[model samples]
Every structure is written in structure tokens, then in C-alpha cells.
Target: MSDAQFWEMNPTATEILNEVKARKIQEINAAYTAEAQPLIKEYPLVEQQSWTAQNTEARAYLAWHADQQGAAPGTPVLDNILMGRNGETGTETLQQLCLAVIENAEMFTQFQQLTGKRQRLVKAVRAAEAVEEIELISW
Candidate 1:
């Protein structure tokens, strides 16, 4: 079954699942942004801001676009940020968002893919986490 279809079919279970999924997503997002804010801020050119998962992909695209338009890839461009936020320029917001996305893509994608009612995603994340812990212990 399609992902949306699977979700729709079991609405009751999905509701609870979605809640837990959403909470996890929020926690991931919050942690990422909180950690990234200081890193981006340390670089004078990049702006520090919080982003939601729904807008991340579009934002990343915009960031890439802006960089191509003479704005430095990692630098903050006021026009790009405003245009991206307002959808004024097809390239601007997507550029800023894109850069932001690239900076946090790994964590964001994990949060996105794991967001569902199924147990597989959780199992995978836990497995990965366990592996990481083991690696760290060995180190």
C-alpha cells in the first residue's frame, strides 16, 4: 500500500502514531536548530533561524538557487531570505532554504523518513543508534 493510503486506512492507529511521530520530529528539529544556530551564528555571514520540516526541501532548493545567482553559498543574503520567505523570487527563498537544508540535511531526513505509524523506522533508528553507541564505546 502507498504510504498515505496505509496511513489513511488505519486512521485510529495512525492518529496515535502520528502524534508520537510528530513529537519525535519536533524533538529532532528543535535539537538540530538549537545546535546549528550557534554554528551558523559563529559564521558572520549566515543567518540563524528555525525551520519546520514541511518547508525544508523547498528552502534547500532556494539556497542552491541563490548561490548560483552570485550569492555566496554559506553567506546570508537579505534579498534571498525575504524573497524565499515570501515566494517572491522563484530562486531566492529556495536558495536560502536549500543552504539551510544542506547544513542540516542528514538529521532532517532521518526525522522525515522515520515519521510514520510503522515500527520499522523506529527499529532502524534504534539499531543505528545502538551501532553508534557501540562504535563510540570502542573508540
Candidate 2:
């Protein structure tokens, strides 16, 4: 509030200011709680980083393969490349490429599961009416 406004409401200004401060503090606490709650309790940061890195690397591989094949980057291209249907073998052997494809698919599935779980948890946190309720949510 401006100086003039504060002085004008002087009689109840202090009380109103204190109430606003309290509400602000509560809001800050709630935000902190929501963020501090880990999506995965064990090695949360490492797990999250691993998921992101794997997903990124897989996507990059797909894009690179797509560019090489002159087609769109997606599972179809990945399948064709792995199945030796593209006839454009580069370095890795068929077996090795197949294994990598399987690994990438598995990682993608895990990443999706993690993402869905985190989204649900965030929704629950936002729906919580109190900090205590938010605190109850876990990975």
C-alpha cells in the first residue's frame, strides 16, 4: 500500500498488513512443500536426470536415423532400421542395433511411466486443501 493509503487506514492498517503477510507466508510454504516432495524418494535427482538423458539420446538417435533414411523420425523408422529393412547399415551390427532398440523401447516405457506418475502426484498436490495433505503424497 502507498504511504497515503496506509495512513488513511491507520486504525486497522497494521492488522490488515499482518493478515496479508500471514497469507503470503502460507502460500510460500505450500509451494515449497509441493516442490520439495520428490517424485522418487531414492536418488531422485539422479533418477530424473537419467530418465531425461536416456529419453534425449533415444530421440536424437531417432532423428539421426530418420535424416539418414529421409523419412520422419518415429518408431516406424526405428523398427525398419533395426530390422535391416532399410538396407543402409552404418556401423553397428544387426544384433547390436536390435539390442539397442530393445533397450531404448524399455527406457521409453519407463520414462512414460515415471512421467505419468509425476503428473498424477502433481495433480494430487494441487488438489490438496492443506500442506499436511500434500505431504502425504509420495513416489
Q: Which residue runs does candidate 1 get wrong by more than 4 Å?
A: 1-11, 42-139
Model 1 Cα shift for residue 30 (angstroms): 0.6
Report the Cα lDDT for residue 133, model 2.
Answer: 61
How many clashing residue pairs appear in each of the predictions shown? 11, 0
Q: What is the lDDT of candidate 1?
A: 0.48
Q: In model 2, what lDDT does residue 21 have?
A: 44
What are the per-residue Cα lDDT tens digits for candidate 2 across 103-131? 75575566565556666766665565555
Q: Which candidate is the best by TM-score?
A: 2
* Candidate 1 per-residue lDDT over residues 22-134, each given as its tens digit: 44545555655565564455545423333443255446446557566664444334445556677744644444555555656556455543343234434443344333332
- The models' CA-based lDDT, in order, is 0.48, 0.54
TM-score of each: 0.26, 0.34
